[model samples]
Target: MTNINDNHVDDHSNIISRIGKCIKQWFIQDFDQNSGELDAAFKNNMLVVATLIVAVTFQTGINPPGGAWQDTKVEPGGHEAGKAILASLHLPYNLFLILNTLAFSMSTQIILMLVYNKKLYFEVVVATVSMVATYGMAVWSLSPDKDVKLRYVFMAALFPYVWRLSFQTFKTFFINYPTK
Candidate 1:
């Protein structure tokens, strides 16, 4: 009877060890099977390219009156028309504009990290792009004359470049001092 009890205790100990191992694998492992599944689902490069294209098309085709090269006034009727369009799409144009800028910037950074197989510093990129985009939007939103509007329009055109620069800066920092 004593020998039988010892065998039962050993079996229980083995089961507990197995469970502990599973838990560690699930939570502590850096690149496990589950992580591989997630990585496959969220292919960063595709997301970045698609989002960038959408942002560029939305900004260039809809947001501004025209390309940066031409000076144009936003007519009262045109503003009304734009508002109508936004209403039809169930979006506030200004809010959508901000979200689009953020999404594009984030996607660009993610793509750069994926391409280089490195981690990026998020705060710096976010701070720089937010500042630039906010200033650009302010100039665009507050302008009262066609020439001033033209300058804002050009500023808007520079958003993509600003985003790229932020990513480049982050990439440099990441390469120099990678986390972990």
Candidate 2:
């Protein structure tokens, strides 16, 4: 019984040590000297806005060229439209785009977490914005009329701007630490 208890204590100690090491690696080591010019809130805001800009640019420049929107073959199904949009880009149908978008969102969260030394709370906000933007574009692409299509184009164009504005508002609210 004594030996078993000792082993259990040793295992617990090892687990604690490993957790400490991970925390140090993730949140503490090189943190003070490597802190960026902006605070956590500002960095998060900047990342969100920058990602939106990049996404908007890519979507507009690559998909539906020359204002010629493509219609979906399947009725009431936007998946075909989404696939067509992806096909028009001539890019591989791999997870690159999805991963890229996720990376952008995570990068913002990580930056904010590092800045504040705490977990970020705005990941849901970023994700919601992205989803809404994507859905809006998909719906517009599948629209049966030119006017609605044009309206979607305009909405897609403004998607990034909306995200930017939202990020700006977030920054204004929480970015109390000024840039050095």
Candidate 3:
């Protein structure tokens, strides 16, 4: 009984130590262990993630779910040409648009961050701006509802900025705030 109790305590201690080590490792920023340099692999992985997100969001924006209206109709209960059929659903469509835009914006931000220190940063910024513009155009053109179009465009264009600003404000106030 005594031996079993001792072994159990030792096992708990080992587990705790392992947990602590894992926490430390996770918190460590991506740096080459030997040279203390930023890991290229980390940057590459981030860039790939960002690019893929942009591509998916762009494709979804252009194609949308349920496709576009086949023909234009000015009558009541009819959809216009080049408008997303999903937009007619209201709530689900709005939710999808918001989430997709959020992903797109955050991914673009990541891309900017990764390339901010690069030599061709200006060119990359221009390309990202163009991509953003294209995405906005896609969203604006595909969404049919006149009332919803502005809202969708605004959300797609500005939600990421709002999100980043809100995040930074919260981080500054709550995270980096001095605790006396």
Candidate 4:
């Protein structure tokens, strides 16, 4: 005689078995649709992106936003204002420093992920988005525009979809990945 507890346990086991079989079947059914080229493309694209971020980080530090460092605050002919390092650690320099560090860190993480054969697409997307934010800070420092709050609001608005897509992309990349 099966007790009620036994029936409950059996029901749970059945549900788990069904879910596992469905997952296995789905993978098996769709495995053939994925091609080797897709994996290679993801790898190649990651390499390109990592290299670009490193390059951009170096360039941003060397050239800077407003311009390269200048000894004088004003140009020789009183034309354009020179971009001297600020008197204190003010917005421009502080922002640049923060962004530069963040960009470097994110890019380095991406590189490490690639080198370690870690195919986590969410990490890559997040690092890319961080780089975007870093560049946005850099741009804010350079531009004389006055719409600070709007940019923050816009970035906040776009972040949810970015995160969701990052997770979705991570799953898809794994699914579409060519298995050896």
Best by lDDT: 3
Segments of candidate 1 deviating more than 4 angstroms: 1-58, 61-91, 117-180
Residue lDDT tens for model 3, 20-84: 66654454333433338667888899899899998898789778899988888879877887889
In order of TM-score, best first, we have 3, 4, 2, 1
lDDT of 4 by residue, 1-180 (tens): 879999999999999988966765454442124432336567668878977877787567545655634443344432223332331334655555455555655565556555543567667667666755665555455433332233443444355455546755655765677432
The residue pairs in collision within model 2 are: none
Stretches of model 3 off by over 4 angstroms after superposition: 1-38, 147-149, 163-180
Best candidate, TM-score-wise?
3
- Order of all candidates by lDDT, from best down to worst? 3, 4, 1, 2
lDDT per residue for candidate 2 within 1-180, as digits (tens), equals: 369889999999999988866744443323234443556576567657756654564464334333433455655433343333443342332233343334444443443444344445466457645754674455344333322224334544455456656655654443454322
Q: How far is 112's C-alpha from truth in model 2 (Å)? A: 9.8
TM-score of each: 0.30, 0.30, 0.69, 0.36
For every model shown, the clashing-pair count is: 0, 0, 0, 0
Task: Write down the RMSD of all candidates, one decimal each.
Answer: 12.1, 12.2, 6.4, 12.6
lDDT of each: 0.48, 0.47, 0.76, 0.55
Model 4: worst 10 consecutive residues (lDDT sum): 78-87
**Better lDDT candidate (2, 4):** 4
TM-score-better candidate, 2 vs 4: 4
